[model samples]
Target: MQDCHILITRPEPENTLSCERIVTHGWTAVPLPMLDIAPIEDAQQRAAIRSQIFDIDTFQYVIFVSKNAARLAADWLDTCWPMLPVGVHWIGIGQGTTQALLEAGIPAISNPGHTTEALLEWLKPAKMKDQKILIIRGLGGRPELGDKLEERGAKVHYLSLYERKKPHYTAQTFFMLPDIHLIWVTSGEGLHHLSEYATQHKPEWKTLPILTPSSRVNQQAKEMGWIHASCADGADDNSLIKATEFHIGKQHD
Candidate 1:
């Protein structure tokens, strides 16, 4: 555990949290963000999301699909509403998203299961008919959550707040071998970029352990020829820490 350097590929703030936790364990945290988060550059789209945020009080419920959405949406909400509108329910897909909401002064319902199916299952008890539900997310994701809600006769709206883009970098931008003991990426896109960066730095280092947030990402890592692809099962801090410790221990063993 001593002197271990974990390569964190998540974006700012989130990666910063990982760094704080890792250093406490006497491990070095190396942040090399692969994806950059930003507001939608299209003026019309940006205006639409902002308009929705302004009219947030009209919605019966607001569901944030990811931490990025929760963070961005919270900022907009903070600016738009001095006092959060009552009678509006807030929900987050995972503990991380819920934590982000809480940090932004929004008390959101959270669950251990971070997937869309899990969210749908949890909402089974509620009567979704005639409910105005707003979904906050980044660009280009599975439509399952929105689709299911709409199918249940709930009016679903998407307030895509940001875009996850790759950061252009040079070979000199990364630390390899001795400095990076393991790689941890929450998204498959991050894992893909990690592979490219690692290969560019030192192709042989692909043998190093890489942890993913889900089984889908683990499978993708394996397909990309990663030998030590490990799934963390969840995206929350505790899940990530436990998975990191388990994988790092397994590697040492």
Candidate 2:
């Protein structure tokens, strides 16, 4: 295990944590952040976010799509709302997001699973007619959540608090790809970037095992001609570590 190297492609702060966890498990962790998270700093957008934070109680449900969404929304809510209003349900899409919300003092936050589809299934049985749901996330994501909520007779609002941009990698970065034993792609965008980089600069590395957090990314990797693409149960750190270990064990077998 100590001889194994796992390439982590998550963004900073998160990448640091993931790398530390891998090291704790007696594996070498190499960080190459594929996406950079930037906050929305436009005056108009900030004003709109402030308005939503002030009127947080109006929405019956507040949904956080990722850990980034939970952290950014919690920052605004902590600033604008002296105290979180009671009776409003908080929904986190996964364990990581749920833990972030809980740490922000949001009580009783619910997380159905790691994927949006799972969350939708868990929410389908709830009464949504005339209910208002606010979704906080990065800019330009899937519309399925809002669309499904609308179909259930719920009004949906979005607070695009951050943007995810592909990071510029130098030639040295791609040179290290051939040495990486395993790659971990947490998001679809990360997988796309990795595929693009590998195709352009390190095509031989495409055969290396890739562990993803979702089926969507796994499919994308396979379509890109990656021979070994495996998916974990969720995006949480524990799931990712287990998946990485399993893939490494299989490689030895």
Off by over 4 Å in 1: 41-43, 175-178, 251-253
Residues 1-253 of candidate 1: C-alpha lDDT, one tens digit per residue: 5678888888877889888988998889888788899878798987887798889989988999889999888888888898999999999998889988998899798765866777788886358999999988889866889999999999998888888888888766654335577888888788888788767776765787888878888899999888988888876667778988887686679
lDDT of 2 by residue, 126-212 (tens): 598889999989999889889998998999999899999989987887775537788888988888887888788888778888888
lDDT of 2 at 199: 86
lDDT, each prediction: 0.83, 0.86
lDDT of 2: 0.86
**TM-score of each candidate structure, all chains considered together:** 0.89, 0.95
**Deviation (Å) of 122 in candidate 1:** 2.2
